[model samples]
Target: MNQSFELTPNRLRELRGFAIAARLLNFSRAAHEAGCTPSVLSRRIAALEEAVGGKLFLRTTRRVTLTPRGEQLLAHCERLDAVMLAMAAELRPQGGEPAGRLCVHLPGAYGRLCVAPVLARFLAGHPQIRIEAVYDDAYVDLVAGRIDLALRVGRLADSQLVARQVGSMRRYLCAAPSYLAAAPALHDPAELKAHRCVAFSGLRTGTLWQFSQGRRRRSVRIDPVLSCNDSMATREALLAGVGIGIQGDYMADPLVAAGQLARVLPEWELSTSPIQLVWLPGADRAPALRALIDFLSSEL
Candidate 1:
């Protein structure tokens, strides 16, 4: 007769750690999400390995890969996670106040300039919920990162995640009043090549600036005097008369109104990027996640 396996509290905790580690494939990140240290997470995985009578992950100094056994275990863990989520949904009271820890991913500059302000109000209204906001310009895999929600700005590719367009942002070619006053007369996009440019590394077209007027489309390659991955840093450089660069209307409009910055080629238009809220599609949406989505949709 085959022996029956039991999942005790400790075993379940270990398995949960294993599942998170498997998804991330990075012990440090898994440890962070699991609310434990890397050493503790490693010990849990080691304990799990002993219980299963096999090594699950092949760990190197730089990377971690799943063994065949680990892959099989991960498949089981996924199913278990789905079951648990569904069960929680069923057990939760209908129309219950949302309360839990919600992890949110946000773009660095937009999050600070736009989203960060409204968060305090959201928290004030929902006192039971705690938020962990990770701000970065780089795209992250939601599932791998175990993120509950993310706000992205730009054209989105088709993916398995569910997305809702919250708003749109207009891009403008802009520079400080100081830079524009002394620099070359820039009546056209072509003139940008002759001027010192501060390039934003996060732009989809890299250093190529695109503009359209009437029926004419222009693309100009700029050799930047300075390049920055962070939009806020780029804005700071532009404000200090470093060079001309693209700035989101939200960031530049106020400065322009204050006479600190001037718009370049106001006649031409740059394409607008949509702001979206994205989350993994699942059978059960936690009430906290739902509440946050609705709140941001209105606030943003």
Candidate 2:
């Protein structure tokens, strides 16, 4: 007869490995955290599954996923981790600045033009906090992407994430003054078809440019001579007098003021979007995250 299963010290270590693996959903990452090899983690997890009599994870080539049993176990593991952290904090000195890794998601141009500068100042103050900024305009799954914060511009769909209005964003049709000088005058929005343009590759394949003034909205289909995914690259093309570019207010203003770029349609009002700082609902309480929010709210 097999001996009755027991929750020994070794079993507790195995559970901890399972928790880390489930949180990251990657065996290698979990193994790194445990300071061991992936093969070691695999054997321990196999043993744990045999002892618990249930499959805790489904390992695939692309990713390691949690099974239904794993999900339940993960929740319990998280609660335990929270309790242990709280207990440990109480015993240790409550000194020093908030210290941890913060992985943030940001739009390319906004990250480079706006948020990156702020983070430079922010990191100087919180030297203990480590930051990783991933720039993209596409949607990111906070949980799966391991993102602690995200800055987005525009209306947010109703979701589980909590958001705060941090600033504002406005688009403008702009071009180099030299380009405007040599090219035919563009008096109306419809005239963009006759002009060369710099387009963003991120735009939907068949998407058309839409503009508005007062209550009237117009859409135009224009061919782009240069298409790019990076905002900075597009701005550089615009500076070289390549074509008209749709740029955010923050990006266009300085160039316009410096005589490098000029607004194409001063009479038209481009749609504005709200800039929001989004995160998990419970993330506000994190000392590092809270410090960043306060800094941005005041600065932005």
Candidate 3:
């Protein structure tokens, strides 16, 4: 035969009683406010104290005050209550917009030119969502850093993250007219070997330059005295007549347009890298993320 058992409402009732007692500070007043007798309220508070194995309140003849632990617990309970209320508000669904913090990571140049404008437009549309944008060239660990999404360029390394191809980008070999005039005339890919090469040197092979013409592809190795990891620094060095450097159109576009830098080897098939927006699978599909991606796709 199964024995009959009833679940206890002791804990929740006790907490309710404690909440009242803490607010009112007087047992009689708390009892009246909680719709229970003073004796019942006292017993409930005692049971709550016993169940938690800690005295939550210090009582005097005239007043009742919370202990340090009780204060901390009260603060936490207040926060929990606030969150519950917010959740309820969200559940109401009165044509409300998505509102929360959005964190994004992007490569440096693209962040400034491409992502920044998209972000600006997104922010304009959804004034509720707060944005935190981080720009860097180094590959950031999205999972470890809790990044909502990343705008990654070029060939992606093997990873578990899902990616959406937003657009394409190409690198170009360019030099200032002054430098091209002062330096030896580069007529062919073979002549690049004789010219001073300003290398970004992030890759393993520093001097190796790849070029293609129709079906013919050639890689020429040269010596570069100036090498740096920072792309902006490399661009500046190229501008300062350090040497001819190959960089992406994102960086080279303004300079090329201004005639500060001229695109070389237009006939040669140059290496091109794709611009992709990447995010982890099973991550929060926030409206902010969707809005950002849509804005970028439309703009870029």
Candidate 4:
């Protein structure tokens, strides 16, 4: 005889955990998002598997993959999630203030230097809402990570997501006054080959720096004396006069105004990257999400 599966609150929690784990395909990441331990998540999945009468995932040392059963359950869970969100929207009082958990993903240095400063004011305005901010330079899937919103810088490639251009990011090739004072006279982009440089490992251009003077374009290949993956680290190296490097205007402008750094080849310009706020469609229906979006759109 087969046992019937009942959806108790505990069972619902277990199913939610299963859904998150299935979406991420990694127990560790799923656990982190679920606000629980991996062992606890594993146990929840085990209980869920027993209730469903089969294994949900095939786990190995390298990766996790969903079983056929898990795929079917995930489809149902997604449908349920949509229904719950819609129901909540309907039940909310008209003109009700937004109140809920809002998960946001942001670029590491930019979030700290720009967005982080404005969050306190946002929170003060929406006293009922709680924010979970994840700062990282890596791109994460909004659906898989269960993120409500993300701030991205550069040309957006994800056509599936709705994006709003909040501002523009301008990069400047700059160095400390000390470095420029001692280094050889730097006039043209091509002359960069002779100078010691600092490279950002995360830049798509790699070691090839591109600049434009009107319609004239120039690309220079530089072997850097130092390289860093983090933007803050690169900025520190530049401040210490390690070598000349490209710095974003948001970070470089204040330093430049304060006379800490000097621009190199001011006549040439780097491509401007767009700063955008992105989210999955229909996600803004939630008042809290909409409120945060509006606040950031105006602030940033």
Best lDDT goes to which candidate? 4
Q: Model 4 reaches what TM-score against the true structure?
A: 0.70
Q: What is the per-residue lDDT of model 1 for residues 1-300, given as tens digits with 9 covering 90 to 100? A: 014345876777788889999999999888766656788889989988888888999988888999999999999889998898888777665666677888899999999889998888899988888999999999988878989898999977634456788999999998998898899898889989899999999999999888999899999999999999999999999999999999998899999999898998999998899999988644126888888898999988
Candidate with better lDDT, 1 vs 4: 4
Prediction RMSDs, each to the true structure = 10.5, 10.7, 18.6, 10.2
Ranking by lDDT: 4, 1, 2, 3
Pairs of colliding residues, candidate 3: none
Q: Candidate 3's residue-wise lDDT over 24-57, tens digit each?
A: 6788887766656788778877776665567889
Q: Candidate 3, after superposition: displacement of residue 257 in Å?
A: 2.6
Off by over 4 Å in 4: 1-90, 93-95
Residue 297, candidate 1: C-alpha displacement in angstroms:
0.3
Where does candidate 2 have its weakest 10-residue lDDT segment? 200-209
- The true-versus-predicted C-alpha distance at residue 109 of model 1, in Å, is 0.8
lDDT against the true structure, per candidate, is 0.87, 0.81, 0.75, 0.89
Model 4, span 1-300: residue lDDT tens: 026788886788788889999999989888766656788889999999999998999999998999999898899899999998889778665667788899999999999989998888899998889999999888899989999999999987765566888999999899999999999998899999999999988787888999999999999999999988889999999999998999999999999999999999999999899999999655787888999999999999
